[model samples]
Target: MTEQISVLEKKIEEVTKRISDLKDIDSIRNLHHTYGYYFDACLFNEVVDLYAEDSEVRFMGGIFKGKESVRRFFCDRLRMRHSNGHNGPIYGFLLDHIMMQDVITISEDGKTARGRYRTFMQAGRHELAEGLTRQWWEGGVYENTYVNEDGLWKFKILDYRGLWHADFNTGWAHTPPNLYPFFSDTYPNDPIGPDEILDIVPKPVLWPDTGVLPFHYPHPVTGDEWDQNKDLNTSK
Candidate 1:
């Protein structure tokens, strides 16, 4: 009787740990969605707080490091270039950033996690500096890493690959990613060139031709042919 009771306790502990890890996965997924919500609404301050202090954010062929760098890149440059308020009738601008297809894996130690997300974005912008409004249909893939810092998950590295950026009216076949990824002229931060980027399909992925995002997880196996190893990199 005593031996059976000990075995049951150990089994219970293992189950508890497994449950906790699954919950962490759910939390990360929700966190990613929450980020899109804040971004679409132009809540720049809220969005900046989502990153860790020494986080790395990569977007538009630019890599921004630390909280200050992320904030500057997001608020100063990107926001200034295009005012993407989702005002339906008045401005007729659209900023629908929908993040889906999350494949998240949490470390066994529960200290770190990595996720791959596909974003379907149809955004329009009206900039005063540009003196015109342009509507675009863009889709991108995000290969991001997160850390559990101070018991809260925050972005450690956000690598976004823009698959397509084309004119909504002309379509991608004719337009392509027709515009060079732009940056604000007044940006005072150190520039990180697009020296080498992820090998995206073609130069600009046209309609019906989707850009492929690599999977971070192992191939699904049958009959427990998998090792439950936790060899993920540290979330530093």
Candidate 2:
């Protein structure tokens, strides 16, 4: 009877864990989608609220650490375009941030999670003086970490690995990103550190022609989980 009771308890624990994971997965999905809509509408404050206090955001090669910096990235650099009135839409926000192919995995402890998704964005820009109106398409991937705190999910790290940006008229085939990289009329705070892989401009190599942002997690098929104790050569 004792042995059978122990087995029953184990089964119950497993079931409970599955239930928690399912709930967490749904919550996380909703959370990220909420972030997208908020950002698209230029509701920068709401967007910032989606992150934890110590959250970090890495977008377009700039790594912004902490909530205040993240706020600046959205509210200052992006939303207001550093108050220079050159880039982005002049009247209203013209961000069409579409996310797709999302894969989320909650950890066994149920306290943290990881997600991977791809984004294809449509952006609008207007130069007030030049009367220059333009539209562009951009593509990138996001590998993010999240944590469950106070019964809510918040972004711990949002790393957006930008792939390319192309003019709507010329399209991606005609234009490579580095050749015509974005020239900001206004500058924002410096990044914590930019990823060095794409540092070289006018290079012999380019994205897709090069490779993708490496998975921060591990091989799903091989189950070679990431290990802090191991180096790149040692797949734990």
Report the number of the highest-TM-score candidate.
Answer: 2
Candidate 1: tens digits of C-alpha lDDT, residues 113-166: 999998988887566433367778887889899999988999988888777667
- Count clashes in each candidate, considering only residues at least 3 apart in sequence or on different chains: 0, 0
Which residue pairs collide, candidate 2?
none
Residue 173, model 2: lDDT of 85
**Model 2, 1-236: lDDT tens per residue?**
99999999999999999999999999998999999887777677788889999888766545567888777677766655422433323463367879989888899889999998899999875554333467788888888999999999999999876677778898888775355333222233234233222332332223434335655667878978654333323111
Q: After the best TM-score superposition of candidate 2, give how far the Cα of residue 182 lies from its true spot, in angstroms.
A: 9.4
Model 1 TM-score on a 0 to 1 scale: 0.74
Rate residue 210 of model 2 by lDDT.
Answer: 38
TM-score of each prediction: 0.74, 0.77
Over the full model, what C-alpha lDDT does candidate 2 score relative to the true structure? 0.71
Lowest lDDT 10-residue stretch of candidate 1: 227-236
lDDT (CA) for every model shown? Answer: 0.70, 0.71
